[model samples]
Every structure is written in structure tokens, then in C-alpha cells.
Target: MTTITTSAPAIGPLSTSTIAPANPRAPSRKSGIAAASLIRLSGLFAVAAGLVYAGIQPIHPADVLASVTTQSWAVIISLKLAMCLAFLVGIAGIYARQAGRAGWLGLAGFVVFGLSWFLQSGFVFTELFILPPLASIAPQFVDGFLGIVNGHPTELTTGPMAAAYSVVGLLYLVGGILMGVSTVRAGVLPRAPSVLLALAALVTPAAAMLPHALQRFAAVPVGVAFVWLGIALLLELGRSRA
Candidate 1:
């Protein structure tokens, strides 16, 4: 007869619980890299949005009700819808990148600007979908809406749209100035673009008063600033990785 003793294996041989060791840092590391990549991608989106914005302005038609049915109007407004969506994403990345240094002003500007984009998004959607069908169904109403947009007089009654338009413009003006000034104070992005952002916001009302042909040019400065900031962000990201 022989006495036999059995105990658990030293390495806990091939059981479910002991097969592998958990890595505490791997998940965090992966998440961090993923976030950084998202930021980088947003920089690219910003550049694309800037280009689209500038490109569309040249072709953007007047706010006449007749333009609503035309192919050109549809195309231009479709582009605008895209621009608003992309800009919203890009701006979030922009703010996140500099948040630490951006301080209270940056926070305020980001919130305000973000809100403006949200409003713009809703308006663009209405323009893209509702306005087209409504153009034929309710011509006068559409005309009045366009009037609210262009500051023209219309016989038709359009409630609250004028006020909404003014609110959107005001938010944009204030937000851009705050963001620009904060960027300048933070000294994170290029100075020229930051300064241009502020200047463009300031001149918007004057530009809006210009004839349609000339009004489009007002977008140039803002577009240029967007492009420059996007480029700067990409460059900064690249340097960090290196």
C-alpha cells in the first residue's frame, strides 16, 4: 500500500480563473489612444468643413423664395447641412484640445458657439427638407420665412422666425468673439487665425447688409481661420507623437 497526497497545482493548471492574468493598465491605455485618434480625426473634419463653407458661399444664392425650388438652392443648402454637422464635431475637438488653458472665456465661448451650431443645424434641416415641399404647398409662407432670413418685407405672416434668426446671429457673433479672444489669450493656436476669428465676427452685420454677391466674401476670413486652426491642431498632434 502507498500513501498519496494531492494539492492544487502551483500554476493552477489551465483552469478558467487562472488561465491568464488581468492587465489593469491595458484598458486605460487603449482608451487614451482612441481618444487621441478621435481628436486627430476631428482636425481633418475641421479642414474639410472650412473648405466646404468657403466653396459654398461663392455659389450660395439669394434668399428669394424662387431660389428654394431651384437645383442650385438644393445643392447649396445640402452642403450647408453637411458643413454645420462637421463644424459642430470639429469645434468640440478644438475646444477640448485647449480646454485646460482656455479658462472661463473659452468655456463660455465654446458653449455659446456650440449652441449656435445646434440652432443652425435645426434651421438647415428645415431648409433642406421642409422648405422644399412647403415651397410649392405654401409659397407665401416660405417667402415670409426667407424674408426673415434676408431682412426683407413680406406680406405673409411668419411668426417667431425673425426673432429666431436674430437670436442665431447674435449667438454667433458673441461666441466667435469670445472664442477668438480666449484663443489669443491662451496662446495655444496661431495668433493670426485667432485674431481673424474675432474680426470676422465683428464685421458680420456689416457684411450681411451687403448685396448677395458681396455678402459671400464675408465668409472668407472665418473660413481661413478655421482652416488655419485645423492645420495647427494637426501639426501640434504630430509633434506630440514624435
Candidate 2:
């Protein structure tokens, strides 16, 4: 019956946690939120670019030289400049977001499409600034350019620019077709918009064949696709954020 006094075992200080008690990487939330916000901004750009690009088509004057001299022509050219710029930015984000899933065909299409847009800016700039001034002084040259635009024969040779015009149209046609097809295959966006994008390219030639009154209608599909894609992008973001 001896008194057994057992000294309580010495308790050392609790190990200091190198990690935060709640979460070590909690700061990352801000970064993620910031990224999502930037990407969402791009979606808005796409919507605007698409709208202006497609909307202006119906109003676009015929591919006649006289059309270039009008004030409305100037306005249309300015709008095209803005649309091309926005397209350059918006499509970049669209392709980037889906790059991983889109694969090589997507990459090729993106590069070709982006290049086409880049080249198109130069054409638009010339139209807005250079061509208009020469419209009066160089009527023949301007008429030649107009002929080149509408796939008609010209009385005067357009030199390198004629070749460039052909190249740009071809690039736009091929690039849009490729991009639309790739986007469809990527499965990132809704199928309807993607299909319309492809269809828009396909119908463009046919649209050109249409009466001048209906030529503008060709742009409707592309415009619709653009708006749809923007809405889709925004909705997707909302879902992800939720």
C-alpha cells in the first residue's frame, strides 16, 4: 500500500505548424478571381466585335468605286477598323481558353485566322485613310481596286495590291472555315454558334452572288455566331464562378 506518486509525463510544446491553421494557400483565391475576371472581359469584346462586324455588312455599300467616296463609306471603314482590332484581341482569348482541347488543327486555324485579321487591318486602314483620298485623283486605280473586291475584271492593273486583295479574301475564307471547324471539333463552345460560323464562311460566296440588297444578309450568320459565343462564354463563366 505504498504511496505511488507517478509524476505526470512531461508535455512538450505542441509542434509549431509551418502550415497555416486554416489554409496555407488561401491567397491564391484572389489570383484565380482576377484571371476569371480578365477572361470574362474578353468575352465582352468578342460580343462587340461580332456585332459590329456582322451588323455593318447589310449596310455596306456595293463594291462599286462610287461607294468609296460617300460619307457612309467612311463611317463603314471606321467601324471595320474597330471591329478588326477587337477581333484580334477577342479571338486570341477564345483560342487560348480552348487551346489545350483544340489541338494542332485548332492551333493552325488560330494562327492563320489571326494572321488574316492582322493583314485585314492594313486593308481597312488603307480604305479609311489612303483609298478615299485617291478616290478622286486616281479614279482608275480606285475602280480597279473596286473591281478586285467584287471579283470583277478591271480596266487598270492593281499591281501588288490586287494580289494582296485576293490573298486577304482567300485567307479570310480559309481561316474562318478552319477556325469554325476547329471550334466545332473542340467542343468548348455551343455547337449552334460553331456551326453557324462554318456556315457563314460557306455562304459568303453565295452571298456575294446575291443581289446587292441581299449581299449584306450574308453577314447575319457571322454576327449571330459572335453574339451567341459571347453569351455562351459569359454563361460558362457564371456557372464556373457559381
Best by the lDDT measure? 1
Give lDDT: candidate 1, residue 109: 86
Candidate 2, residues 1-242, lDDT tens digits: the string is 88978565544554343333877476798877887777677788889889997788767877677888899999888999998888877777677767888898888877877788889899788778877889889978777776766666475846787888767767777777887898899999888888888788777777777766677777778778877887787788878999
Any residue pairs clashing in model 2, and if so which? none
C-alpha RMSD (angstroms) for model 2: 6.0
Provide C-alpha RMSD values for all models, in order: 3.9, 6.0
Worst 10 residues of 2 by lDDT: 11-20
Error (Å) of candidate 1 at residue 74 is 1.5
Q: Quote the lDDT for 116 in model 1.
A: 87
Model 2 segments more than 4 A misplaced: 1-31, 153-159, 211-213
Q: What's the lDDT for all of these models?
A: 0.84, 0.79
- Candidate 1, which segments miss by more than 4 Å at Cα? 1-27, 153-158
> TM-scores for all candidates?
0.86, 0.81
Q: Give Cα distance to truth, residue 108, candidate 1, Å.
A: 0.9
Worst 10 residues of 1 by lDDT: 8-17
Tell how far residue 80 is off in model 1, in angstroms. 0.3
Q: List model 1 lDDT by residue over 1-242, tens digit each.
A: 99776665655476566767789999998987777778778888788778887878777888887898889988989989988888888788888788889999999988998788889888888888888899888988888877777677476645577777788989989998998899998888888998998899889989987876787788888888888888888888878777
